[model samples]
Target: MNDEPKSISIKDIAEALNISIGTVDRALHGRRGVSEKTKTRVLKTAEQMGYKPNLAAQALKLNRRISIGVVLPKHISYFFDPLRAGIRAAAGAAMGSQISLEFHEYPRIGSGDIEALEAAHARKYDGLIFLPGDIQRFSPLIRKISRSGTPMMCVGSDAPDTGRIGSVSAHAYISGSIAAELLAHKLPRKANVAILTGELSTLDHAEKLSGFAATLAIQAPHLTLMPTLEGHEKPKEAYRQALTLMRQKDRPEGLYLSTANSIAVIEALEELGLLGKVQVVATDLFQDLATLIKSNKILATLYQRPFTQGKVAFENLVAYLTRGNLESPVVQLAPHIVLRSNLPLFASRISETDEGEPESDSLE
Candidate 1:
């Protein structure tokens, strides 16, 4: 009464096609030594037989455990938390790969990043996933680590002309352009707009400022651009700068928080009772940001896909290390613009955190 198809294995595929088991295995696994015509035949036969390769079993054959070092900032947990979540999700997907992820957290970018890099380098991991702060400061160290045989994969931002094998991040320049375009439309009349961001030494923050300034000059020439306020992603510093910027005689009509450290600036805006009066464009999203968005306190946010960036970075690094697939790919995900109208679609991704606090544990 039961007529179900059995699972097809490589042996079944080889037998069905009258080929050697070794040839079938080599072709299926993309191992060299198999002819092109034979590989095509084996692939066709495997597909026709509905064979599925077990990645875990394939990895088990390698007889080695892969270890990865992840170095990221502890500040701005609103973005970094989801980034770690993504890396964990990717590691989970590759279960039985015998992969170990070691997370090393620094206070913030440009602070303890170099020390963390040195510590992780001493361990001699197979690969590293890192967020580069200042290119000039990190170039020599990254090159040293690479020359020592560990591949470095940059995430969140890039350090070019260095030894980084690949990078995965949201398009930072486009995020700024989007913010500028949004504010330009909201304030059709001549108005002043200011950018609140992190240190200019960080590549991502600098790129965002560049994009916003360029777009404002081209599309919204009537809008006056104010001097950038660099809080260096410190909460107290950001709050103080924001408060001063808002209280100035030449107060800006529009504000763009280019970094994920928007809560402090938002609090300052609230303190000055300029919540709804000033059009504010924030970065990333959390529970508090969602509430603010619904209450019209914030206009829009450019959601950088942090989780995807981490997931892709981990997956690509694994592929490069295990399969010798050194494509050195640079993946740039487009920033998701979240408005009040379509906020519900992105509700599932929002983390339930009132404050941006970093996690304590380093090993997982």
Candidate 2:
């Protein structure tokens, strides 16, 4: 083992520490092992070198097919459509992977524990792509899987310790920055902003708010966003909160929510007949919102490609499985602005592919 940490294998320790391979092997397995003092030395040396068990090698030895199970937040039209498309594109590109992928969707993200747990049973796969629940609770399980050599990836939001693990998602903080810009340009002066949020314990929620507030401090100095109203990740519930906010004497000019479930906000604004007045900005680009954009209702939106997210994850796993390329330990797609006038610019029109050219990704 080197002084600086290394991903040492048994052979490395045998050579570097000048111990016999048999001694090193016995030390590792504890099979009537070596002398306690020698075992301790070997173990200490291995730990100091950052030696980790190789799960991929074992899977290959066991002749396990490389498969990844993808967990998503329901097959709702908003995130699913594009994410599914990206999955297909990525899957096609991962020919060397020789792997299969499956998706498990959960409808009740904010509340349903039973259904979510049941969906975790991916009997045929080797790795996972998780759209996680509460990070404080779910992180340990994710970590445990990673320790066991499963290449776990997450999109949308993630838990703590995600840096050492795997991810293919957006810079949520940048998304918030974009939202701040959208709000800044729409409003003539700085005013109160209201954000509908879910459990703040989630990392994405925290980072996004941080990004929004920090950027607002610099860009829209007069803007004062109120304390978060728990939207419970339900659009209908968010709508109710929007109603209450609209009733306030000092109503906010900007309304931002970090969920695909912010459909409630629209309905709420519609109910108060103040949909036009409230500068609504959020994280989803659903078909109805697209329609509304055409009519000049939605000012702008922040888009993350969930499909590309899923596809990239699959491609990564397959590439690792087939080509042994492990350099890409993390993936970050860029964030883009989608305004009403240029909404069509982002259209992942299936027909666009027939023109013998790739579609434009604005963030690129």
Candidate 3:
């Protein structure tokens, strides 16, 4: 009686193809109960008639909804905000279609963090997105997620051993290397440079430092880089620590920071009235810092694509769910360079040369 061609139903297909309902059902499930010839004939006819399964109706009949879980730290990260916006946009686009999404925030990986992660992951979500804070300590948690048979994506960090289904992380070593190379090009030949950072593990602090050092060796051999100062990735705390370094008499001409709490450091520079005295470069972008770049309070920043990450992660999950490609490939979306000259083209171009290619420093 109902004539809605928009809805593809099993009953509709069976009736149109003049097949018994039982035969169609068995063909749909690939049941061993049906004869091989009947199964092939029924499926061929269904395909020829443009038969399509309704995920929503199927889920209702089977009593299982496609669910996805996302985990993130609750700290005030300027990058995460935009990333969240992208994630919501991507998920909302898929709403009332196939999947349901849930978001969980844990401020840090503390005493009960593992328990919390486990509990949230225990839900029968089809997939997961995680910002893994500390990989070494969180290895067990990662393993647990892997064993749960749900595809997992690691954003901001690469968790290779944990069976991460995909990753969308910045090329940290290359970002830091670019800062060093660019600073050399912009500054005086003998100028001294210094670096400030958060904990080395979380921000890929060590890898960035390696890039900076390597780039410095080839492009600005005469330049000097002071010892790295740990800033704890907090604005006020980093500002306080930076005060001592900023006041030093033969202060470095370039200040490099690969940090999570860069706002305070920039403010500290302003307070010292040394805003333009030292060129500064950092790892991520913020609204205020982009303003500073236009005003020349900061020199350059290597921008990572968090928004693209959310989109890619969701796509990975969707592919795994509908297609049954359970072991989804690990994908790393490239990073971007954000300078005052070009904030508009944030994630357009490739940030660095691929790691596989043999590259030697060139002073251009």
TM-scores for all candidates: the values are 0.81, 0.77, 0.73
Instruction: Write the residue-wise lDDT of candidate 3 on 191-297 in tens digits.
Output: 88988887665535666888898899888898898888876555676888788888888778898888646878878888989986788987776667767777877
Q: Write the per-residue lDDT of candidate 1 for residues 278-299, one digit (tens) a residue.
A: 9999999888999999898899
Better of 1 and 3 by TM-score: 1
What's the CA RMSD of model 1 in angstroms?
10.8
Q: Which stretches of candidate 3 lie over 4 Å from their true place?
A: 1-63, 108-116, 324-328, 344-364
User: Which segments of model 1 are wrong by more than 4 Å?
Assistant: 1-61, 95-97, 326-328, 352-364
lDDT string, candidate 2, 156-261, tens digits = 6665463224566677788778788778887768589877776566677777788888888899888887878777666666677778888899988887776656
Give the C-alpha lDDT of model 2: 0.66
Native-to-model Cα distance after best TM-score fit, residue 24 in candidate 2, in Å: 18
- Give Cα distance to truth, residue 159, candidate 1, Å: 0.7
Q: List where candidate 2 sits over 4 angstroms from the true fold.
A: 1-64, 113-124, 162-164, 322-325, 349-364
Best by lDDT: 1
Global fold similarity of model 1 (TM-score): 0.81
lDDT of 3 at 59: 59
